[model samples]
Target: MTETMNNVLNDDKKWKIIQGDCLKVLEGFAPGSFDAVITDPPYASGARTQADKQKSTRQKYSSMGDNAPPAFEGDAKDQRSWTRWAAEWLAEARRIAKPGAPVCMFIDWRQLPAASDALQWAGWIWRGTAVWDKGNSRPQRGRFRQQAEYIVWGSNGDMPISRPVPCLPGVFKYGNPGKRIHLTEKPLQLMRDIVRICEPGGLILDPFAGSGTTVLAGVLEGYRAIGIEVTDVYAILAQERIVRELAEAV
Candidate 1:
């Protein structure tokens, strides 16, 4: 590793959160710097038309009025644009990951297909999709409830069956966080469970660390983690949350 990369990972803590464009920050890492990639990226869904997609993330995803979490960037892309962008980041992430490094990306139903395509287009072996059943959601009269998100998981290449990881579940049942600091923040325990896909004490990366859940979980689970968040507000929030939560856990 380069001097700077080593310094960043060997800091006082086992985790770090970098604030910048993920595409740009991801380029700064050395090849094979990480053992896994686990993240919940902006889905850029919840709308149909291009104009609708351009709405602020809060407007597009929440209805809590002024009480909602702050809006984030990079969620305004249309389908084609989002797919291309996903491919670029996924390719970069794959480059930074070690051989056989596992990757888990969270996405809703709307972008599930595109996410899988991006994962393969970026040269990672396509594994299977896991479900995150929220257990509850606003019920629709005639249609099914949208209570589940997906984790599209795979490996860099040739993940050996002998890798020191446990048998993980295909479906995770967890409710959403009751109090969220980010609009699409995921449940912390869910993140903790997901980070186990990496071998113990391995390093992990989360290119779209909206709230640093993956980074925090990795550290708590005995692995190193690095998170990249583009939005300034969320970058600060994520860092603060991770630090505070880690301190409390200790």
Candidate 2:
């Protein structure tokens, strides 16, 4: 699987997006193969009940009705199951990440506690949380607007303060992209900023490629990156979008 990844990266010197199960694909990497792990995994948190949790990704996330993007996999698990699965993959990601490598995982309020628990269970040093204020969301009659998601960030172990990375903000404000190819696509600029947590030119790993936003952002910011996506439609779509957008920027 890593060899296949290398072949893909050869087509574009700085980045690669592989189509596979991240759990299995991660096993192909050697210990300490990556400098950082940054990804927005499936939150599995858009529902109030277990039955609602099993609804399709599009049904849970999209307000566009029939125009919703294609549904993706791995977002239907219940809370316990999602936490266990998160810990399992996170452990694998840590195994491949260099010592002191930073990790940033995206989650919503419903799963924030679980995500933090899973991170510590996976053996990462729980650093702190960062906010991604989306700037707008549906206002409720009396409750506060659910207008933010969190990045649960940490490190493999003993991240030295001497690292050259900048002092990043604890909060980022960015609206969702006006157009999206995936059900939960992040803004490209948000990803570019997040990738800065890695040292300059370090390789970053994003286990959930979604629309390949992280992979593209990494390259544009002068770092190498690899992304793994399981859904076939998105794997193809991400590759095309990365190739086209990169070419256009040239």
Whose lDDT is greatest here?
2
Clash counts per candidate, in order, are 0, 0
Relative to the true structure, how large is the alpha-carbon lDDT of every model?
0.92, 0.93
Q: What is the lDDT of residue 41 in candidate 2?
A: 99
Put down candidate 2 lDDT per residue, 101-191, tens digits, no spaces: 9999999999999999999999999999999999999999989999999999999999999999999999999999999999999999999
- Estimated TM-score per prediction? 0.97, 0.96
TM for candidate 1 is: 0.97
Q: Flag regions of model 2 displaced more than 4 Å.
A: 1-12
Off by over 4 Å in 1: 1-3
